[model samples]
Structure formats: structure tokens, C-alpha cells
Target chain A: MRFLHTADWHLGRLFHARSLLEDQAHVLDQFVALVRDVRPDAVLIAGDVYDRAVPPPEAVALLDDVLARIVVDAGVPVVMIAGNHDSAHRLGFGARLMAAQGLHVAGRTGPQASCVTLHDAHGEVRIYALPYAEPAAVRDALGLDLPSHEAALQAQLAAIRATHPPGVRAVAVAHAFVVGGAVSESERPLSVGGSGAVAAEVFAGFDFVALGHLHRPQTIGERVHYSGSLLKYSLSEAEHMKSVSLVEIDGAGQVTIEPIALQPLRNLRVLQGELATLLAQGMDDARRDDYIYAVLSDTGALLDPMARLRQVYPNALAMERTVLARSGQASAAGRQLRELDTGTLFANFFREVADADLDGDQRRTLDDLLADMAAAERESA
Target chain B: MRFLHTADWHLGRLFHARSLLEDQAHVLDQFVALVRDVRPDAVLIAGDVYDRAVPPPEAVALLDDVLARIVVDAGVPVVMIAGNHDSAHRLGFGARLMAAQGLHVAGRTGPQASCVTLHDAHGEVRIYALPYAEPAAVRDALGLDLPSHEAALQAQLAAIRATHPPGVRAVAVAHAFVVGGAVSESERPLSVGGSGAVAAEVFAGFDFVALGHLHRPQTIGERVHYSGSLLKYSLSEAEHMKSVSLVEIDGAGQVTIEPIALQPLRNLRVLQGELATLLAQGMDDARRDDYIYAVLSDTGALLDPMARLRQVYPNALAMERTVLARSGQASAAGRQLRELDTGTLFANFFREVADADLDGDQRRTLDDLLADMAAAERESA
Candidate 1:
């Protein structure tokens, strides 16, 4: 069966205070067009449909209009779930009612297990709708202290496996920060400490694993894939190509993944040049249609980069100047400071900048920094 | 043509920290069911689809599901616009593309003006989408230096009248605070000073004016009506019967407005009683299906009423104590204090609260309060 597998739409969200609605809408239009052209049997919006638990009205309307066009007008069924960015209670509001209309919404982690089985001409395809889960929630739901996201997910998968008929094709949709996966600077930190990392091997038995949360489309193994966000939500994600994935599963449970292109509303380009050079060249072409982040390399003094860039890119989000390196070698005092342990360096910097007092214990800790830095350097080298 | 007129959806919004998605979705479900049962020709979402310019993702998905079911699945066209709560530029993102699928969206007040002529069995109905026109934007759009919202709106209506064919039924949709219409406490004050109140007669020529912004379903005139918000966004609007207005216009320009019932996910109730009384009453029935606000009227102080209310109605949005009487009554000292001029009262209050020193001029101003109060009282009664 042919189906479109996409995740991390994060609709109605913004990059800082700037609205990403237009960019999001443009990508959604492409997704809708893809559904029409590709004629996929179903569209799996894996998770993270919204950026917050509570979205604004326009965001709601925009999503409503787009989804209506895709599902009802274009004749495709949509299977969606709540992500960490979403409030499960809010998303699950009318799941039972909407499910009757062929739109499957799974916003909650089931106590036992949650899976939606779709029967097509080829065979029975069981979709495990696993919304973003915290370790405590997973443990409580499964009636066991699973310890980690990987272990909890495995437990849930085990429940699904026990219930599933033998030899049926299965796919799991999830939103998590997995171990050994590349993380973009734009993606939010999932958790603190060692608990954040979920082992990618958790989905070993599934035919395919559609992931969300991480905004860069990539694969962990042969079967697990992230569709990424519909648009680059942050300047940090400017280099990543945003797209949805289309997966085809045969009767044998083998899956093939295809990436569909998305038309970006604005081309996020970073221009690195000296202030004078950028001003002389002007931003005539960039001004026409795009959001630009300009970095001006001015060595000697500070300049009003924003004032200059606005003349070219009126919607320039941010601007910064690159500090030039000192021509001569550092002074003995500066070299001593650099060579000091990180703790000593941090203490010295903080004391110099803030003119604050340090306790005897703190000063003693700073003295031990050289040993720590040496150990770290030795390990890395 | 029969259409359901609704506005101020404020999707992905919160009443403080409480998510209103469930309440919003419930009302939208009722709206969808109404459309399915009543079979309206179109749905008019006047404006303010989101509470803020940037909404969370789940709100987007919820709206998407509702619109899909009503418009795309039920074969009903939707006409919507942006309100003051929205960022016009963001809302208008995919308007052009969505227009192809019969969803009309207008976010800005443009020079060309936005008028969509919908063809029906009766005849062509010219629907002019005015969006939320600020005085400044309207003045700029019409090339007038000193245009008020009333004048600008009148000019726009005149332009529409001049352009559209004679005898064609016309209905106008807008998002503005009109004079003599009751404003819900939840609605943000549109304009400072006298600017917010646009005269109702500005919409004189249209057969029907589907209005938004105020989250109360009411009429300014015989033909101009507000559909109100989908749910009570604030405790102040608890008594409001949230609804959608279904309007039917004939070829002869005769208009009929019908109220469509909205089923709130939870009823908003305000309880005025002592803490003990409220608790002893056992709010289990109300707590089970209502978002409540409790006003404690305890003569003697009690420990946190909020904590107590949460023990019963966990979804209580707000709780306040009614220490002061509803009437404007006070003790002799209180009356004397109230008689003080605002400036003097402010200085004295600040002196007492902040323990700050006051000058001789501040003391003299306090003496003038009694004289001003006596004169005002004599003039009044």
C-alpha cells in the first residue's frame, strides 16, 4: 500500500516572535498537491502537528483549511498524533468523533497499547500511534518502571506485538530524541542528563518507524525515518532541506521511502561579507523574495548592520558583525588565561565582567580546573 | 443562500494557563453537526479565528479537522477574514491557493478591495470581505488623510455599491467593534479613546453584515449581527450562550438570521457563597461537566479558596472573594478616603503602601479633595 509518512508539521508556531504561518502554508500546499498527484492511499502525519499546546486562531484556521482540502476534497485519509509540542488532552478532544469521519487522531499514550489497523487489498497494516511519552507516563501506562524512553517504548511495542496477528505488517509513529541521530540546533532539548537519549534499536521488529520532534529528515537505520518539519522554523535549520516522506509497504512487509519536495515560502540565506562590500553590492535580488540573516565582518569598530540591511532586506530577522582576529600573538597574561583550566577561565571571566566576589571554595575549585581540562583534552585527542 | 455565520474562534488560545481547545472543539463539533443537519450553502467565519497571531499546533489540527468535515466533506464553501487579534499578513498566507478549493480568506484591506460573487440557485450574491480595517490602513488604502473607521468603511461600501451590478444581493463581513453593541469583557479593548466605537450605520447598504471581534451573539441593527465566540474565553463571559448565526438571504435582498445552538464542552458557572457553603454543597455534579469560577463571600477569612475549589472543581479558572458589597456603600473613613482627589489619593496611598515621603504640595492636594467631592455631590443630587 502506498502512503505518505510525514511528521513534525508544528503548525501555528513561530520562530521566536516572527510568524512562520506563510512558510508553513506554502509547504502544506505542496503536501496537499503531493497527495493529489501521488495519490497515496493514506497520509500519516506522525506527530507534532502544532508548536504549542495552545495555538492561535489563525493557526487553527490555516490548518483547518489545509487539512479539509487534503482529506475531504482530495480524498485521502489522515492519521495524526500529538507530539511533545502538543497538549495531548487538547489534541485528543474529539478523537472518537473525528475517527468516524476517517481522520484518525491519536493524542494519548494508551494504558495497554494503542494501534490503528488499516486493511487494504495487500494485507493488514497495523500503525502504532505512539505520541511523545515521558518516562513516568510510560511507566504508569505500562504498569512497570521502564527506566528509559527506549525501554518504555519497547514495552509498549511488546504489548502491540502480543495483540497483533502473526505476519501482519506493522509501522510505529513516534516523537523522541533518539541516540546516534543527528540533532539540529533548532530542535528543542528534550530532557536533561542521560535520560534524554532513546536507543534507536527500540523499533527493531517494526517494518518502519516514522519519527517526529527532530526537524531534519534523516534515517537512523534501514527502517526508521524522520520526515522533518514542513518548513525551516529557525535560522539554525536554514541549511536543512525540509520535506515529507512517502513510504510504500508491500505484502511482504518490506518498505521503500521516497522524499517529496516542499516549496519554501522564503529562502533563508545567510550572507557573510564585510559591511562595505555588502552595502556596495546591495541586496536587490535578496530583497525581492526571501528572509535574510546578514553577518557583517567589520574588524575595527561596530556598525549599524540592521540600519544598512533594512534598505535591502526589509524583513531581515537578525544581523551580527564578525569580530576580526588580533594581528599579533596574545600577551603572556592572555595566554596564561587561555591555558588555565575551564573552571578558572570561567571564574576569571565572570569576575572581570561582573566584578563579583568569589568564595574560598570556589577559588579552590578554579585552581583544580587545569587538571580537568588536561584530562578532557587527553580523552578527546 | 443559507450560511452559518460565526466569528472569534480564538483557536489554540488559553484562559490564563487553561487550554480552551476542548471547549472550542466541542462548539465546532456542534457547528459541523449543524451544517450536516441543516445543510447550509456556505459557512461564514467572520474573523478572529485565533486568539493570537501565533497559535500552538494542536489548535491548528483541531480547526483543520472541523473545517475538513464541514466544508470539504459536506461540500460547503467557507468565507473567512482576519480580526484585530490576528496578524493579517500571516492569515493571508495561502489565501490565494485556498480560494481554488472554495475557501475565501481576506486578511488585509487592499486598494482593489475584496468582493467574491458566489453563484447560487437564487442568483449571484456579492460577498464583500472587509477584514478588520484599522483607521490608518483604511485611510491609506482609500488615499484619504483624515479618515475614521466609520468614514473609511462607508467609502468602501460606497465603492462596492458603485462597482457591483445593481439589484444583486450583497452581504458584507467585517471584524470591528461597533457602537451600541454589547462588548464582552473577554474582548481586548480595540482602540484607545473614542476610536473603537464605529457607528453601526457604516454597514447601512448591505443586506446583512456578519460581524466579529465581540464574543457575544447580538445585533447592532436589524441586518447587522455578531455570531460571537465558540466558547467562553474568560470568566466574565460565563453567562453568554455561545452560538453561530445562520443567515438566509433571498434575491429581493430580504435577510433572515437564525441562531444555531453550540454545545460547550464544559459550562462556565460562577458561584457566589462562603467557602464552607460552597464546599458543603458538594459541587460534584457541576464539577463533572463545568469550568467554574467561585466567588467566596466569607465574613471571616479562610485559607486559600482556590485550593479548596480545586479539591472539587479542579478546572476552576478563577476564584475571588466578595469582601466588598455590590452597592457603592462604605464606612465614614472609607467615604472620606473615596472623596479624595485621584492625585492626592494616589500620593497618600503610595505613601502608606510604599512608605515614601510626600511634599507639602501633595498634602495641599489632599485638602482640595473634600471641596471637589462636595461640589460634585451637589451638582449630581
Candidate 2:
């Protein structure tokens, strides 16, 4: 049986504070076209169907349209789970009815008494769909107060394993931060302070495991894979390529996996150079249309850098003055903030933020505030 | 053909700035029960399914659950339209697929493109469901620049009339104000200035007209009716008898209209008395649970009247100091703000808001402001 594996669509993601709905929609259209060609028996979306627990109305509408096109138009069965970013209740609302239409959404769900079965020439393949559940939720469900993310996921997998069928291939769909997987900056830490990672060996008996919660696609074992997110959700992901994984299982229960690349409408690019050179001749016209994250090397004065860059690169979403950033960092390496004089601190803060020094009148206001503080301190003492 | 007609559910409505979700859920549960008992051939909701165009997730979930219960479980076909409050495209997503499951949602629909047909003992009953269209939308759809709300409604009616079927009973579901319908303060004006009332004569061709956008249950003709909102939406609708319209159309082209009352879980109420009296024994314990809008008659100052009233009426949502209100209104009738001194003006404003005059310190501050103003004006001159 052939099935597609993907996760972390993050449909309503706001990249650098701008809505990525159009970009997402464009890529999803391509995905639909691909699905038509591939004609897989089923598509497994591991999790993170929405970027937030309560997505915007347009996001909901977009998801609705895409689901209809996939399940109704393409006539392919889909099984999805909820990620940490999704409201399980919202995602799980029409699960039972959608299952009839070949779209099964499993979320806010417990360890199923039995795994869902799909058939091919191999006879049957058992699939266990586990949504991202908090450690508290897992504890409540199993009557065990697990201490960490790994414990919770292991417990969930163990429960499913207890019901695991013998002598047939099994696949587990999960959203977790497993140990030894590469990390991206945009991923929210599932647990506070400590690591939220589970060991890769937890899925020992399963033939294949589909994963989410990391936006970088990589494999930890022959059978375990992270499909990653659809688009560049963060600038840290600017250099990483994105793809969906395909899993083909044989009649003898053997599995072969492949990662299929997606052609994004606009690639995410991080460009670095002096401001004038970057805009005038150094940058390629072909890459100019990409979503640009620019770093300027100029140490001297620059005026309205973001506004000026926008004139040439309309999609330049973020900007950084490397000279100012490094200088500010150097200046702050020695002293505590409260120990510094208010005037110097204020000037440093203004320069760090606005990349400019205070004018004469603004300096006078700061001086007046310092004088008032001196007077109040003297009186209190 | 028998059907239940209701409108202006305004399901996520906030009454006196408090969420009425529970109240709405209670009434809708009763409504589902009614549909089951009545076994109506279909249910017609004219418009305003949600209080806002983008309802909160819980409201969307509530609507989803209710629709599933009615259409999937109870097996009744539902035809609903978009009102002025809803974003048509968002509400109309997946409408075609839903229609296959006996739920017909009509919105962002062109003028008179087609009609939904429901079967009965007769050949069929053609239901023309027209969503609320703005003058601009109507003008664009009909390719004519209309002048007023009446013109827009007339144009839409004309388009629907152009497709009117003969010899079968026809019902038109609309969301608009007709001429001579009783005005309620809480009903949002469909257009600016004058009235957005289209004449009742617009429905001349249709056998029956089910209308919404008027919070009052009233009739303009023998076959035309306003089911009103399922719950009292505004204080102005405190005395309105809310109900769902029951329409039974005979195979012989005859029609019978009945208005069935809906019992709200907690009724909206306005209560008047002195603050202490309201808290102690003025209001009955049975009525205390109602969402109360309190009007305090005490001429004396009262501390946290809303807080005190809430001790008895946990749902006390609003308060008005009648004595201070009328006195302040009477005091300001013939006065000009620039003609009065700062002290007197500040005193009057304070009394109007807090039902008390300024204390010595506050009065001194007002006198100092007046002195500073006089000095500034003199220096300018």
C-alpha cells in the first residue's frame, strides 16, 4: 500500500509578522496537483494542521477548501492528528462524519483500544494515530503522573503497543521532539527548561513512524522520519529545503520511503551585503522577488533602512544593521543596566533600537529626568 | 411541506457586555428538540447565524454541533442564508457538499442564479433563499448602480422573480427590513440615513416570505412573517415574545403559518429601584438569576452599585444612576462648556459620571487649572 506522509502545514503562520496565507495557498494548490498525479491510497498528515489553536476565519475556510479538494475531489483517504499548535476540540469536531468521507481526524483522543486497519495485497496494515498530548493529559488518560515529555510519549506509544497487532506492518503517526533530531529556532519548547525529547527507540516494533514538531526534515532511524513544515516559517529555516515523505509498503510488509521536494511560489532567501551594493548590482534579479531577510554591513550612517530596502525588495520582511548590533552587544558586555547612568543607558538604548543618537531636545529631557531622580533620592535618604 | 423558520440567532451575542453563549446554547438545544418532535420537512434559518462575521471557536463549534444534530442525526434538510452580520464567503465555504447532506447554506450567492428544491407530497416546493446583499453588491451583481436599500432589494427581488416557477408553492427567505415593521433600537441599521425598509409589495409574486433583521415578531401580510430572534438580543427587546415560525404549505397551493414560542433559559430583564433595596428584598429570588439591567433610583451616592447588585443578581450587567442622570441632563440643557469656569465644569462632569461632586483636593486642582488657563490666555494676548 502506498501512502504520502506530511506534517506541520502551519496553514495560518505569520512569517515575520506578515500573513503567509497566500504563499501557503499557492503551495497547497501544487500539493493538490501532485496528489492527483501520485494517486496515493491515503495521505497521513501527522499534525499541526493549523498554526494556532484558534485560527482566523480565512484559515478555516482555506483548510475546508483544501480538505474538500483532497478527500472529495481527489478521492483519497486522509488521516490527520492534532499538533501542539492546534485546538484538538476544534480539529476533532467533525471526525466521525469526515471518516465516512475518507478523512479521519484524530485529536484530543486517548490510546485507541484498536488501531485503524487499511488493506492492500499485503492483507492489512494497522495504523496508530496519536495526537500531541500534554504530559498532564497523558497522565490523566493513563492514571500515571509522568514527569517529562519523553515519559508521556513513551507511555502513549506503550499503550498503543500493548494493542499492537502481531505479524503485520504497523505505522505510528506522532508529533514530538525526539532525541538526536535537528532543531529549529521557531519550535516552541514543549517543556520548560528541560529537554522535551523522547528517545528514537520508543517505536521499536513499528515498521514506520511519521513525525512532526520539528520544521527540519530528517531521519533518526531507517523507519522514523520528520516530514517538516510546508514553507519557511522562520528565517532560521531560510537555507533548509522542505519536502513530503512517501511510504510504500510491500505485500511482505517491507517499507521504502522517499522525500519529494515541493516547488514553493517564492523561496525564502537571506541576503547579506552593504545596503547599496545589495540593492544595486550585487543581488540577482531572479532572487529579488524572494522573501528577503537582509543584513547590512555598513558601519556609518544610513537613513530609513527598512523603507529604503522596501523600495527595491518589496518582500524584504526583516532587516538587521550588523555593525550597530555588534557594537550594541559589545557595549553591554561589561555592566549591569541599573549600575549605568540613566543618560548613557538611554543613549545606548536609543542607538541600539533606532540606530541613531538622541537630538539636543531629547537629551535635555533625559537630563531633566536624571536631575529629578537625584533630587528625589536625596530627599528620601 | 412543513418547516421551522427562525432567524437572527446571533449565537455569540453579548447582552449588556456579557457573553450569552450558555443562554443561546440552552435555547438552541430546546430548538433541536422541537425540530425532532415537529418532524418538519425542513428547517429554514433566514440569516444571522453568528453574532459576528468571525465568531469565536466555541461559537463555531456550537453551530457545528447543532447543525450535525439537526441534519445528520435528525435527518432534516436545512436552508439558511447570510445576514448583514456574517461574512458570506466564510459561511458559504463547503456549502455545495453540505447540501448533499441535507444542509443548504446560501451566501456570497449571485442574485437569483438558482433555487433549492425540497420534496413533499406535492411535486416540489421551490425555496428561493436570498442572502442579505449590500447596495454595492447588488449594483455589481445586477449590473446597475442602485440608489438605495429599497432599490437593491427591489433589484434582487426582480432577479428572483425573473426565475419564479409557476404552479408550485414558492417561499422566499430574506434578511431585510420591510416598510412599517416595528423598529427596535438594537437592530443594526442596514444603511445610513432614512430607513433601509423595502416595501412589503416586493414579495407580491412569492407565496410566502420568511424575513429576518427585525427583532420583533410581526406580520406585514397574510403569507409574510418575521420569526424574530430566538432570544431577546437587546434591552429594547425586553418585552418581545420570541418564537420560531412554523410554515405548513399544502399540496393544493394553500399555506398555514404558526408562530411557536421558544422558552429562553434565562430571560433578559430590566429592574428599577434604590441600590440597597435591590440588594435586600426589592427583587424576587426567582427573578434574580435573569440577566438584569439595573436602574438605580437613589439620589444619594452609592458605592459599586454593579458589584452590590451582582451579589443578588449574579448576572447584573449594567447600571444607571437615574437621579444623577436626569439632573445632569437638566443642568447641561442651556449651558455652554466655554461659558463655565473650569471648577464648575469639572464639578458638573464629575457629578454626571460618579454621582458626586469633587472633594477639596480635586476642587483645588480644578481652581489651579483655571488660574493657569487665565495666565496663558493673557500671555498669548
Candidate 3:
């Protein structure tokens, strides 16, 4: 059985408050081309199909196009699950109807409804899709004392394992924070205010485990892998190499995995140097077009450094002075103290009260109130 | 042949800063129930399926479920088009693939792709879908001088009229502000900075014209009708009766229309009376449960009136003083002139200059510069 295992597309992601819709669309176009070339029997997208529960329309449109190009054009069955960042209700809208067209979307983790069987020259290979499970929801559902993320996941796996038929190969698709996987700022915590990591040992029985939720591609155990996010979503992830995993399993249940790196439309990089030299002739044409985080090495802060740097790199997102970083002291002491004015302060106060902008009547009333209070204070004194 | 004609769902609408997803869901639940009970041959959704170009996730999920229930479970065909409030690319994402499943989503008004044919016991009936068109797009595509909304619509109708065959009944589904139709604040302008209403005579050739974009159920001509919105969107539309149009056509090119009212989960109403009297046993239980627009007849302005009103009516959305309405003059002159401090003014200017917020060093520098400027001004005076 051959399958292209990928996850964490994070479509419609905004980087540093800038829209990445066009860049994401470009990468997905290449991804469709790659899927067409491989022509895998099935595609396993572990989780985090969208950047958020409510993605921008452009992102939804892009996903619609790419899914068609894969399921209709490449003739590959797409088996996907909802991740922590995804809303299960929103993602699982047309699961039953779409399954008829070979687009299997699983939003809940269970033994019965979530397992889909596919055949690829080997007998039937059962694919189990486990979406993100909240601990409280799972605890109430199974009437178990599952106080942690690992316990909830373990319970789900145990149910699947109990129903597993002997001698039939199974591929497990899941989204979780597995032990020993590197974390990034972009991944939302699976559990709120608690330990959310699950041990890798629970996935040992599956022939191949396709995982998501971590942006760095790595293997947790034998036959278990994290395909990572398709694109780098955070500045700390600048050094992370994004890739998709392709798994090939033999009839005897042996598995082999290959990591295929995707070329980003615009690479994310951190550039450090003096502003003048950097602008003169320091970087290549490719670096000039990349999304840049500039760390200026100059001892004195230059005037409007970001504006000057944008002349060299149009996509410069953020900048900072390295000298300040090396000072090793917090700069809060040098900040200005806030002072209030009656008119401005009243506007802010009314804004808080009304939860909106101050209208003409409210502003005039505030002005009169301030004037009256001053006069009353004079009279009292 | 009988068909269910509806439009202007405006799913995901935000009324008075409140999410209407729950109200919309309730109305659609009844809408689906209506479709099931009627068991029409086909369904015609003219336009404005979404509240905005990109809808929230919950709205998309709701539409997905309802469309599947109507198309797959109810065993009926649905032909819909995009409106001015929708993004064509987003709404028509899976047009061809969905059409195969008996759900036709049309996004453009061209001659070739906009027509859908449905078969009934009588014979085959042609349903032409006309999505909202920008004058510039229509002019460029047709190579004509389409300077107005009516002109563009006239050209499209003329093209369809030329292609029409004899002795067969046809229905044209459109989204436009037809002449003499009552307007509402909720419907967005179809054109930029000008009149967007088209004449009703443009749709004269069709046996039935299912229309949308006006939130009032009314007839524009012999065969043209507006189904209105499914729910009351604005305060002005609180008195408007909302319904879905049901049309029956025979093989002899004859047509009959009927309006079916929808029962909302929560009704929207405008109430004007003394706040104390209105809250003290004057209104019925049903009105208390409604979305109320309170125009207080109290002569004196009450403090925190909205907060107090919400105690009685949980969904009290808007409140205004009758004195403000009776003043008979604008109140912009009674406003306070803003006086700026050195720090805030400097920070605002610097934000404009750098297109970002100030850090520690910039703040200290601005404070020093402002002090120096103040001293200089005092010395000069």
C-alpha cells in the first residue's frame, strides 16, 4: 500500500499580521503537481487542514480547488482528520456525502464510524482516523476518569485496539503532541492549563502512524512520524524544514517512510548585519525576496531602519537592535509614564463603557462634567 | 412542475453586533422542514447565500449540512447563484463536482455555464441562473457600453432571450435591486457610488423570475417576484413579512405562485414606550423573548438604560432616547475639541512615521525632545 502522508497545511495563515493567502495558494499549486506525479493510491492528511476554525474565504476556495485536483484528477482517496486548531463541527460538515467520492473526512475518534478500509494490491488496509479529543469531553463520553490528555488518547486507542482484527494491517492517522517531538510557538496547546503530551508507546501496534500538530518533521518511534506543518508559521520556525512523508507498506505489514521537502514560495529567514552594508550588496536575489527578520548589529539605532531595509527586502516583517538584546537588561525603566487629559481620558472612558467610539452627545456631556467638577472644587476650596 | 424558490439567507449575519448564527440556524431548520413537507421537484435559491464575501466557520458548516439534507436526503435538486455580497470564487468552489450530486452552485452570468436543466414528470425545464454582475465586468466581457446596472442586466437578458427555444417554459433566477421594490438598510449596494437598481422590464421574457437582494416579499411585474430575506435583518425590516416563494409551472407554459411564511425562533420587533411601563407587565411573554429595538419615550436621559433594559429583555439590542430623535437638529456642533499632550502627540506622530509602536529608546528620546520643545516655546513667548 502506497500513500502520501501530509498534515498541517494551515491554509489562510497570516504571518506577522500579513496575509499569506497568495503564498499559500502558490505552495498548494505545487503540492497538487507533486500529488499528480506520485499518483499514490491514497493520501493521508493527519490534521490541521485549516489555519483556524474560521479560515478566510480565499483559503476555503484554495482548499476546495486543491481537493478536487487531488481526488478528481489524481484519483487518490484523501483520508483526513480534524486537528486541535480545527473545529470538528465545521470540518466534518459533509463527511458522509463526501466519502462516496473517496474524500474521507473524519472529525471524531471512535472504533466504529472513524475507521475506513482501502485496498491497494494487498488485501484491505484499515485506516483509523483520530481527531483531537478534549479531555473533559472524552471523560464524560466514556464515563472514565481521564483527567489528562494522554489518558483520553490512551482510552481511544485501547477501544480501537480491542476492535482490531488479527493479521490485518492498519494505518493510524492522529494529531497530538507526542513525546520527544520539538514544539514551536505556533502550535496551540492541546489541553488548557495542563500537561498535554502523550507517550509514543501507545502507537506501537499500528503498522504506520501518520502524525500532525508539530511543525518540525521528525520520527517519534519506529513506523511513527510527524509530517509537520506544510509551511513555517512562526519566526522561531525559520530554521524548521517543512516536509511531507510518503509511506509504502508491503503485504506482510512492513513499512518504509520517505520525507519529501516542499520548496516555499517565500523562505523565512533571520538576517543580522549593519544596515548600510546589508543594503549595499550583502544578500542574494532569493534572499531579497524572502520574508526577513532583521537584527541590526549597529551600536546606535538608525532612523527608520525598517523603511530603509524594505528597500533591500520588500518582505521585511520585523526588525530589532542586537545591541539592545546583548545589554541583558530589561528596558521597561526607560518607558514614559502615561498622563491623562479630561477630553481624551473621557473619550477613552466612554469607549470602555459603551464598547464603541464616543458620539457627539457623550463627548459634550463629558466636557461639561469635567468643567463643572473643576468649578465645584474651586467653590469648595 | 413544482419548485421551492428562496433567497437572501444572509447566513452568519451580525445584527447590532450580535452573531445571528443561532437565529439563522433555527430559521433554516424550519426551512428544511418546509422543503421536506412540500417535497418539491427542485429548489431554486436565487442569491445572497452568505452574509459576507467570506462567512464565519459556523455559517459554512450550517450551509453545508442544510444543502446536503435538501439534496441528498430530501432527494431534490438545488440550483443557486452568487449575489453581490458573496465572493464568486468562494461560493462556487466545487460547482462541477457538487453539480454531479444534484447541487448546482453557479457564480457567473455567462450564456454557456449558468443554465441548469432539471427533469420532472411533465418534461425538461430550463432554469437559468444570473448572478450579480459588475458593470465593468459585463462591459468588458460582452464588449458593450454597459454604463449602468439596468443596462448590464438588459444585455444579459437579451443574450438569454436570443438563445431561448420555442414552446418551453423557462425560469430566470436573479439577484438585483429591481425598480419599485422596497429597499432596506441591510442589503449592500451592488454598484460603487451610484444607483444599482435595474428596471423590471429586463426580466420580461421568463415565465418566472425568482429574485433576491430586497428584503421585502413583493412582485415587480407579472412574472418577477422577490422572496425577500429569511429573517428580519434591520430595524426598518422589522415590519416586513419574510417568506419563501413556491412556484408551480405546467407543460403549457402557465405559472402560479404562492408565498409561505417562515416561523422564526426569535422575532425582531420595535417597541416605543416609557421604559418603566414597558418593563412592568405591559409586554407579553413572547415579546419579552424577542430581539427588541427599544425607543425609549422617556423625556429624561436615564443612566445605563441599556443595561437595565437587558434585565427584563435578554435580547434587547438597541436603545435610544426619544428626546434625541425629537430635537429636530444635528448635534455635531456640541462636541469637545481634542487637546493633545506632548507624549501622546509625539507617540502618534512617531507611529505614523515608523508604521509601528515605539520601543524604550524611542520613547525616552521623544520625551526629551518634547521637553526641549516646550522649554523653547516658553522661552520664545
Interface Cα root-mean-square deviation for all models: 15.4, 14.7, 15.9
- After aligning candidate 3 to the native by TM-score, how far in Å is the CA of A293 from where it should be? 5.1
Q: What is the lDDT of residue A301 in candidate 1?
A: 71
Per-model lDDT: 0.74, 0.79, 0.78
lDDT of 1 by residue, B278-342 (tens): 77775546454477777777877687778787787777767665565433433334535644445
> How good is chain A of candidate 1, measured by TM-score?
0.82
| Alpha-carbon DockQ of candidate 3 | 0.17
DockQ of candidate 1 compared with the true complex: 0.05
Candidate ranking (DockQ, best to worst): 3, 2, 1
Model 1 Cα lDDT, one tens digit per residue, A50-149: 8766665567567667766776688687778877776665566445444555567777677855667787788798887888766667787778887666
Per-residue C-alpha lDDT of model 2 across residues A1-381, encoded as one tens digit per residue: 888889999888888788889988998888888788999878889899888776776787788888888888898878889887877666776554456577778867564522568888768888888888767667877889887778887888788777676887888888999899987766765553346689999889888888988999998878788988998887668888899988898877677888898988778887888999888853567766679888889999999888888888888887777787687864234324533455777789999999999998888787667655643432221
Model 2: residues with Cα > 4 Å off, grouped in runs: A54-56, A92-97, A107-117, A126-128, A137-147, A158-169, A272-287, A295-314, A318-381, B110-114, B137-147, B271-288, B294-381
lDDT of 3 by residue, A1-381 (tens): 888999998887888899888887877787788888988778999889988766666676788888888887777889989887666666675665677677888775443438888887779899988887676556766778886789888888888889899889988999999888988767865643334799998887889889989888888777878888888888768899888877899999998888888888889988878988778764565558889888788997589989989988999998877688668533221211122344665577678888998777876677567655643432221
Determine which window of 10 residues in candidate 3 chain B has minimal summed lDDT.
B329-338
Per-model TM values vs. the true structure? 0.56, 0.78, 0.74
